[model samples]
Target: MFWDHRLTQICKENENLSKYSTYEIGGLARFVAKPRRTEDIVLLLDQAQSSGMQTVMFGMGSNLLLPDHPDPETIYISMRDHIEVMPRGDLLYVSAGTPLSMLSLFGDLSGFTDFHFTFLLPGTLGGGVYMNAKYFDNVMCDYLDTVYYIDLDAPGRGIQSIHVDDCQFAYKQSIFQHQPWFITGADLKLKTTGAAFDFERINDYLNQPLVKESIDNSSLASFYRFYRSYLSSLEQGNKPVPEAMMNVVLDRTGKNHFDYPSCGSVFKNDYTIGTPVGKLVESVGLKGTARGNAMISPVHGNVIQNRGGAKAVDVIELIKIVQEALHKSFNFVPEPELVIVK
Candidate 1:
């Protein structure tokens, strides 16, 4: 039993975590905490440490896969509602819970134009920072001025702020990956634009209809589509073919409903494979292949989708099967993009 009576509105027992993630697939968390203030989070951490309890922090839950039956010993920290933002001239200090979509809207409304590219992404500022989320030739690290994070190894536990350069960001990774620090907030440096950035192209992409009757139902949006098209174009004499191909794929795959409960791209591209894995999978006619409700999307081989009521194990098993087949056929193992909660 937790004795911290001060945490009246911040705690929950056996909280269902499925509703929090994009995949909507996870077991209950033994304990869930939603502290209003940063100090409260520190105090909660202190108490959990004293009690020998392990802690995990989650934002909007976009790119995670939790176990079907999660370990009851774990504590989940939901920072969804603790969001707070303060503007400082060309910069904005933002708390971890602030969603990227909301931040992008704030930027647009406030005349800060650089963040417009992030308007369509489903992620929190913290997770964006962690993954260095990028699109339209810009990344989260490009606008970051500083980061404030909890120091798990401090002799006297507390939060510390570090400059952007110190974060050491690179392709979907950061220094925080090796350290035990938890991001609490960040400072974003923005610039004002005289003209409003046009989102007509993005809106057009989003408005496309899903190909419901297609044999390959796996669909992709944003980066996956961009990357796949880039590779396909390179294969075709490096001409401007990808631009046309993207439109074709987008038209065939329903735009708005593709990412309903997906773990995003189930695998990362392996450059050593020499050939794009999607083409390889397509060549083998594995597109639209299904394993107990988990299907290799026909729209894009890199994507795997949950048809209905698909279990985490089912997704994992399908991933394994795909990996094995791809490796045996092509002699290269694919890396998974989704982070599995074991």
Candidate 2:
């Protein structure tokens, strides 16, 4: 009865959790909360602690999977869509709630060039910094200055600010992943060249038909060369990669990912393995393999797709099959990147 007063102020019980994930394949979460204010988050955490309820916080649910059967006693917190952006001098102070899409655009609009690397990622700043999200050579930690958190493991429930260190990172790993702290915001350091590109013209040029690859078969080289030169000039003058260019990267990499309900990549890249697990999966001919509605993608071996009406158990089973095949055929052991929320 006591918990009802505090918790019910921001949480809803027996939520359909499938709606919250990119995979769209989760069962009901016992309770779900989206706290718009920082104080609301503190209060929720406090009440959960007092009531002895286990709470899990996630950003966009892009890289997570729920358990086959979840405990109803658990509580889920989503910081996605709770966006706020503020500038401190030449750097940026981003709320964990800010979505990556908005964050990247904000930087471009504000004439910050280096911040464009995260322009097309699928989650919020909370998950971005927590996981140290990366694209190409740039990772969140590369620009991260400090992380702000509520110390659940510490006495007095302290809000701590910690700088990034080498121990806090690995290939798709972070300290927050193993700890009980909740990240609320981050301070990032990025350099800008000063704003000078005429983005309106860039936008118009991007919308033209000649920009399409098929439009200039013989002169494709010239078009691309000019485009590259333009982008280089903008970047040198302190401007982001054009939105159209980022769109190209997005379109190129997003292949078959949005085709169905599935986490983008089921397995993490192992540095020592020397080969991408996707290529290995293909070599073993496990594509299009199925366990119920869940199956390994024919288009991409690393992806496990929910063909339709897939269950968590179905995906879990498929993962086991792939794992077994990898170990047996290639003597390679695979590790999951997804957070299975059982």
Candidate 3:
């Protein structure tokens, strides 16, 4: 293959696509290439485009679902090896493939504590930037000074630099997300503090008893559902409720020993409903519901998991069922967080 000779490492006819993803469920890739350098990536893209092969660029594969039956015409490009980082004054030029968790650790070690939240996330820099990914409303776009991307549609395969404002960032979306632009790197503007930021204190805060224990146990996946449930109760004027609903969901779901597969929250919150979707899910009996190797996380109705050997179709089916149920019950449609590869 062209990639074999041109790139540092390239695998053809690989069937272990599931291992690369957090969900741990996927079919084979006809071609999976990992270029050692950025230039090699451009070369590979050019070759793929010319050959009329469909390409999917992936970072850490945190938020994607590959079909159970592989697409023979498609090639998967792994950007993990293209990791690069350069500190230019107060800004850091980071390759899209860099893991957010690693970046967080880097910041902590380098005494850049202001950006510690980036580390706790389970995504890559490119994916984060693309989604304007955020926690607590502190989004990636807020720190991005500029972004460098490859235009797949242009003649001669042009590269473009986008300013922060031009990205059109919003809740879990960016302009680059819908286009054929392949993110190369990002310029992250960070702040420095006079006193060294206390990594221990921050770690303690992140590892709070309630939050840490909930996430540590898989059964507690329903913690979000409980949170939504409690919020709903509050809205409904319910008083004297148990204070540990969140903890219960977390502890119960964490004990599940099924296949460690997930698409995170398979549904997005519907804003028009004026009430959180989690509350609606709890109202129905979908929480902790299970079907052939697939279950609507009893902890959280929105999260679906593969008990073991669950197919992408199965997850999709559960999502559809949930959407229909919600629509029938509350006249609302829940959006999926997982992007299905058709």
Candidate 4:
């Protein structure tokens, strides 16, 4: 009853959460608040904070692996449509709700001429900036000039802006990830890769029969391309291969677990540990492993798939199996990167 009626302006109670995430698992959110304006968001946050309900924010839901039914008392926020982008002279102003792909596409379409949108955004700009989302070698913070964030409790500052340096950006992490604040937007002073590639041409190229034949999602050809790049990275003294990526072995043997619904990668590519997490799972031979309807992807050791009607507990059980196996074999415990909530 803490939220009571204060959030009536911009909140919907018991909105189903399953459709919001890319993983497409989860129960209803007690309150799925979509505040169109800053004040609306503040008021909703205040209602939740004052009532002591747990809160979680999500964007595009590309990185989340939520439960079949989350806690009914918690508040879920979706900022996907709350904000927009703007062009102010040299700066490309980005709002948190803006999808990364939108921003990049805008940059390309706007002929920002000098700036080439390089990062492959799998989700929203807010999530990307929060985690300093990375693709291959590029990162979210690399082109950022300034970031604007809202500290829910700080009404006097309205929204505060921090320079790129002070934003504390690191590999796959940002200050926002640690700090208690919501990123509102940012100012990006971008650099271009002169003579930007024609996106339409690229799209046309992708539509080519040869290219389409080369990339069979059904057959895992795309996965193989990624795996090849990953292996090439290691061979050419490039960075270590991403553990969650489907293995080249699977590609060579024509194996793909993509038939089932999956959350792609389940764990982060942590190198501080001795062996890679995926390798540890592979070492213990947990690939193609199953728990209820949730199964560890056979082709990609780090992936966990939902084989229809899978419960969150099933995935949790599979994760525990991998963790336990790794611990038993290599004495290492892998950290889950999925945004799983009870």
Question: TM-score for each prediction?
Answer: 0.77, 0.81, 0.78, 0.74
Q: How many steric clashes does model 3 contain?
A: 12
Candidate 2 lDDT: 0.70
Of the pair 1 and 2, which is ahead by lDDT? Answer: 2
Compare the candidates by lDDT and give the number of the best one. 2
How does candidate 2 fare on TM-score? 0.81
The parts of candidate 2 lying over 4 Å away from their true place are 1-7, 154-156, 193-244, 247-254
List candidate 4 segments past 4 Å from native.
1-9, 111-120, 153-157, 193-261, 273-276
Where model 3 places Cα greater than 4 Å from the true spot, the runs are 192-259
Whole-model lDDT per candidate: 0.68, 0.70, 0.66, 0.65
In candidate 3 the C-alpha lDDT for residue 126 amounts to: 84
Compose the digit string of candidate 4's lDDT tens values, residues 133-241: 7655567787788898878665344578889999788867788877888887888666665533344443453344643343222122243344354246555886443
Better of 1 and 4 by lDDT: 1
**Model 3 Cα lDDT, one tens digit per residue, 180-224:** 898888988765645343434444544446533332221223333
lDDT of each residue in 212-279, candidate 1, tens digit only: 11101112244234434433644686543333334534543453334546765567666566766667
Candidate 1 clash pair list: 209-254, 210-254, 216-298, 218-297
RMSD of each: 9.4, 8.8, 9.4, 8.7
